[model samples]
Target: MLRKHIPITVSHELVHFKQSPLKKEHTLLSTSIREGAAEFIAGLISAETDGTLAEFKGKEITRLL
Candidate 1:
């Protein structure tokens, strides 16, 4: 179980790290993209690429953009 989550967790953290330099408050769009990017990258690295962990029925976070 823990092993299964490693990809997504690491991807999520990476996205956050990339956003750390943002000097302004986060907007809904930015936040959505951040999470979406993490999810996307996670999917790419995860063995289960069917997007079962997605909040919606899409492969990318473009739905929120």
Candidate 2:
């Protein structure tokens, strides 16, 4: 599972690097949005989504629903 996610991880970090004016607010909501954006975009860019497993969690929940 960890190995499968590496590409997404790298892409996620790269997305963070390219992001301008990185948010560093001291609240959970802000942090969640910032990280979630990276994860969602990274999945789209990296093409490492779990279509087979249908985890239906996190980023995929909205699409699944």
TM-score winner among the candidates? Answer: 2
**Candidate 1: which pairs clash?**
none
On the 0 to 100 scale, the lDDT of residue 31 in model 1 is 76
> How would you encode candidate 2's per-residue C-alpha lDDT over 15-50 as one tens digit per residue?
889877644555788778877888789889987752
- Which ten contiguous residues of candidate 2 have the minimum total lDDT? 50-59
Clash counts for the predictions, in order: 0, 0
Candidate 1 lDDT (Cα, 0 to 1) = 0.66
Model 2 stretches with alpha carbons more than 4 Å out? 21-24, 49-65
lDDT tens per residue, model 1, 2-41: 6767666777677678765654887899878877776776
For model 1, how big is the CA root-mean-square deviation?
5.7
Worst 10 residues of 1 by lDDT: 47-56
